[model samples]
Structure formats: C-alpha cells, structure tokens
Target chain A: MKFSVVVFPGSNCDDDAFQAVRSGLGQPVSFVWHGSEDLENADAVILPGGFSYGDYLRTGAIARFSPVMSAVKRFAAGGGLVLGICNGFQILLETGLLPGAMLCNSNLRFICRPVHLRVENASLPFTRSTRVGQVLTIPIAHAEGNYFADERTLAELQRQGRIVFRYCALGGEVTPETNPNGSIDSIAGIANEEGNVIGMMPHPERASDARLGSTDGLYIFRSLLDWFEQMRNAECGVRSQAAVPHSALRTPHSK
Target chain B: MKAKVFVALKRTVLDPQGKTILAALRDLGYADVADVRQGKFFEIGLSDGLGAEQARQQIERIARDVLTNPVIEEFSYQVEP
Candidate 1:
C-alpha cells in the first residue's frame, strides 16, 4: 500500500519514518508538506515524531493548526488510517483526532532512552504483530509524553479496552518508577474506539530497524500495512462499510 | 487588541515542570509557597476591531486546536484593552 508521511515545519523524524517504510520495507512512500492538501493516494498517513514549531506553545499545540492538519482531520474522519507518534501524538491530541493530552515526563527532563512498552491490544492494526503483554523496547525522546485522561474518561477507556500500550519494566507490572512518563495507568498509546486512528508517545518507527538493536517496532508497520491492504480490498469488494467516518463511531456523548 | 493566554495542567494531572519549580522555590527559602502548576502563556494580538467576544472565540478555537491540551490543561486569558 502507498504511504505518506507528513512534514511539519519542525518535524525531524519524517525522514526516519520515510526511510523505515520506504527503503527498509521497499514500499512506495512520499513526504507531504504540512501546507499541502493532498494525501497523494496514500493508504496510510503517519504524523512522524519531532518538535513541530519547536514544541514552544505546548508540544503539539502550534502544529495542530497547520494547513495540512485540516486535511489530515478530514482523512481521519473518512476512516482513513492515521498514526501519530511522539510529538505527532501531541498533534493528534491538538486536532482532537485522538482524545486526551500529554504532560511533562515524570522526571521533568527530556527522556531519551529505551523504554519497555507492553502491548495491550494486539487486535488493533497498530499492534497486531505482537500478543497482549508482549514487551517491546522502544526509545522515547520527549519532555512531554505523560498521558492523562479524566476519571470518568479513564474509566470509560478502561472499560472499552481502548488503552493500547503501557510502560512496563522487564518482566514486571507498570509502576511509578517503571512508568517513564507520569502517564495515568502507565498509558503510552491509545486508539479511538473504532481503532482507525492511533496516537502514541513512544517512537515505534525508531525501533523498527533491527540494526537499532530492536526490531520490536517493525510489527507495528507491518500491522498497519496489513490493515490498509485489508481495507483496500474491502473497499473494492461488496462492503458498503468502508466509507463510514470515525467521528460517527465515537461515543454517542462525544460531539 | 491582545490577549495573554495562560494554559496550565489540571490538578489531577501531574505537572513535573511545575513541581520542579515548586521544589526549587521551597528549597530557596520561599516557605509560604502553597502550590505551583507550570503553564504556558501566549500573547495574541488581534485586529483593531476585534470585540472581546470575538477575540475569546478565536482564542478558544486556537486553544482547542493548539494552545492547550484540553485533557490535561485548562487555559484562561486576559484582554489588554
């Protein structure tokens, strides 16, 4: 499936994501400028990590209003696949594509280290390559990766199993110290109820390369490919369900 | 017209930066400091004809879409009339 990565003004990881999917997987990929309106026939749209607008007004704050975000929002609304990593996750939060927000890391520093993330929902396109509880080592480089949702929303998310990833220690439960960021319930990633869009604070693309000492993130890319391919086939087939919007799939209370 | 938007993390959500600042304040002998919550401030200068309501709406739009993460932070603003 064709893929496109968005490049915001200060986006620094678009190249890495492009290389990982295009060169690493030998797949067709292109970069779409933040001001562009085209999705370029891409089956998947990824907002790669990096400080967009220098993370000045809040990590994803300024980037969310970029010209391209409106298009991305439209695409996601149309049930197209979307993934936001790190600062991209912040952007998704800003765009309201994904609910919730990120806060300063618990340590109050730019944490740049390998963190152990446990897969909680392998059934989703973002984590299908691994089983629930599978441990993946990926690096998180950000000052604000801590996730927070209100008590009622948190309960709803828990009840819905929307919680997808959690910071965990090797062979241990996710705890305060093990939670790299002060994410509630150690949340690292979450998907909208429909699961077409995902936002995660960890850089899965960074870990997709085996030479990076961890190929754990490759499964995510593979899962995304499989998901898009399936959706493409479904669209061509007799299924009238392909065009439903993600916003329509949100909780009835959500506007 | 201009407005300074102050966005701060919710009390329920931990604020490491604010906490660090609080710690520094307490350590530096500011004993009366009750609490500290780190936040962001944005100075938005609008058109000359911008009314307070119009400006608030515009600023809130930016806040919802950018200036603040609604899940964790709440934003307030003051107008410079």
Candidate 2:
C-alpha cells in the first residue's frame, strides 16, 4: 500500500512518518507538500506532527487553510484513510474532519514523555492489530494536547465506540494521574464516524523503532498495512476472515 | 477602516494560564481580585476598496471563522469607520 505523508511548512515529523512507513513498515511512501492539491494516488494519508505556520493564529488555524487540506478533506469524504498525529491531530480537529477541539494542558506546561495508551476499539481499521484494553507505550509531546468536546458529542463518541485510544497506566487502568495532557475522558485518540479518519496525540511514528526504546507504535502502521492486505484479498473475491471480519471492513474507498 | 477582535475561552472551558495569573494576583495581596481570564486581541486593517458594510461583514467572518474556534472559544469584535 502506498502512503502519502502531508508536509506542512513547519512539519518537523514528516521524515519520521516517512521512515516509519518506508523502513519500519516496509511500504512505499512519499511526502506530499502542503501546497500540492493532489494526494498522488495515496492509499492512505498521514498528517505528521509539527508547529505548522509557527502555530500562529492558533495551533492549526492557519494550516487548516493550506491547499493540500482541501484535497485531504475530499479524500476523507471519499472514505480514504487519514491518520493525524500530534499537531496533525490539531489540524484534523480544526478542519472538522474530527469532532472537538484542543486546549492548553491543564498544568500550563509542555509535556514530553512516553505515555501508555489503552486501545479502546480494535475492530476499526486503525486498531485492528491490537486488542481491546491492551496498553501500548507511546510517546506524547505537546502543550495543547488537551482534547475537549461537548457532553453530547462525548456521549455520542462513547456510544459509537469511536473513542479509539485513551491514556492509561501500564496496567491498563484509566486514571487522571495517567492522563498526560488532561484530555477530556482520558482520550488519547479518536476516529471519525466513518472510521476512516483517526486523530491522536500520541506519536506512533516516534515509537516504531526498537532503537527508540519502543516499537509499540509499529502496531498502528502495521494495522494499516494489514487493513490494505485484507482489502486487496476482498477485491480478489477471496474470503479470509483470518483476523478482521469482512463486516468490519466498511472502507468504501479501498481499491 | 479597521477592526479589533478579542477571543477568549468559553466559560465552560478551563483556562490554566488565567488561573495561574489569578493565583499570582491573590498571592500579591489583591484580596478583591475575583478572577483573571486570558484572551487574545487582534487589530486588522481593511483595504480601501471595501465599503463600510462590506468591511464589517468581512471582519465578522474573519473573527468567526479564523480568530476563534467556535467549539471552545468565542469572539467579540469592533469595526471603526
């Protein structure tokens, strides 16, 4: 599967995402500049983390107007897969691809550390490689990572199982002390209603390599590849309920 | 024409920076200080081609769609002739 990593002007993690897909996941990947209006046949798009537009006007306010975002929005509307990490998650929220908004961390300090995340929904394409309630150690680095949504939206997300990941302890306990950014409901990540778009504060790319002390992040990239493989087999009329159920693959844009 | 916009976190949202400032103020012996809510201010200059009504509309749009994230923040703006 081919991946396109969107690179905004201030995107510092583009290379990290590229490397994760290319070397870690062993998939073909390319960097799509923010000014580009096309995704260039990308099977999946990734918005990597960084302070785009110097984070001026707001964390993602300026970057949301980038030319590439329109293309991304269209791709998502078409049911194409999109994974947003860190500041990319902020961009996704600002673009309305995902619900809710981000606020400054409750402690008023920039947090940079490896935090544990519990997979809340493994049936989705993004978390198919993990199990429900499984804890993975992933690093989170940001100041405005506190996720916020209204009570109604929160209840809706909960009801739909769209809350994909939550900050948790090593033992898989969700607690206030374990929430690094004070995100509402301990949310570390979430998926859109269609299940194709995912936005998360954790830096999965940064954790994809063993040399980086943890390869737990590789599961997310692997899950995408797994999804693509399952899609390809389905296209060939080969029924394989090996891992993900055929019913779970509701991705309409898979080709 | 010119416009001024002020943006602030909604009442339901928590403002850690504002709370920290409030603590500092109280520490300084300002017993009457009730609260401190941080906000952002912006001054925008309009181009010559726009009329008064047009400028007001444009500024309102800018403040609504750009200056504030309606999910968590709100804005108030003033246009000067």
lDDT of each: 0.81, 0.91
- As for candidate 2, its interface RMSD to one decimal place is 0.6
Q: In candidate 2, what are the lDDT values of residues A57-76, reduced to their tens digit? A: 88989999999999999999
Candidate 1: stretches off by over 4 Å: A231-255, B46-66
lDDT of 1: 0.81
Q: What digit string (tens of lDDT, one per residue) describes model 2 on residues B1-81?
A: 788999999999998889999999999999999999999999999887779899888988988888999999998888887
Q: What tens digits encode model 1's per-residue C-alpha lDDT throughout A1-255? A: 667889887888888888778656556777888878887776789999988989876787888778889889888888888989898888998888887777677787889999998888889987776799988888999988878788887888788888898999987478888887788899989998888899988887888777888878788898886676566667788544453221211111111
Query: Runs in model 2 with CA error above 4 Å?
Result: A239-255
Q: How close to the true structure is residue A44 of candidate 2, measured as C-alpha lDDT?
A: 92
Q: What is the TM-score of chain B alone in each candidate?
A: 0.88, 0.92
lDDT of 1 by residue, B10-57 (tens): 777777777888999999999999899877778988998989898888
Could you tell me how far off, in angstroms, the CA of residue A202 lies in candidate 2 after the best superposition? Answer: 0.5
TM-score of chain A of 2: 0.93
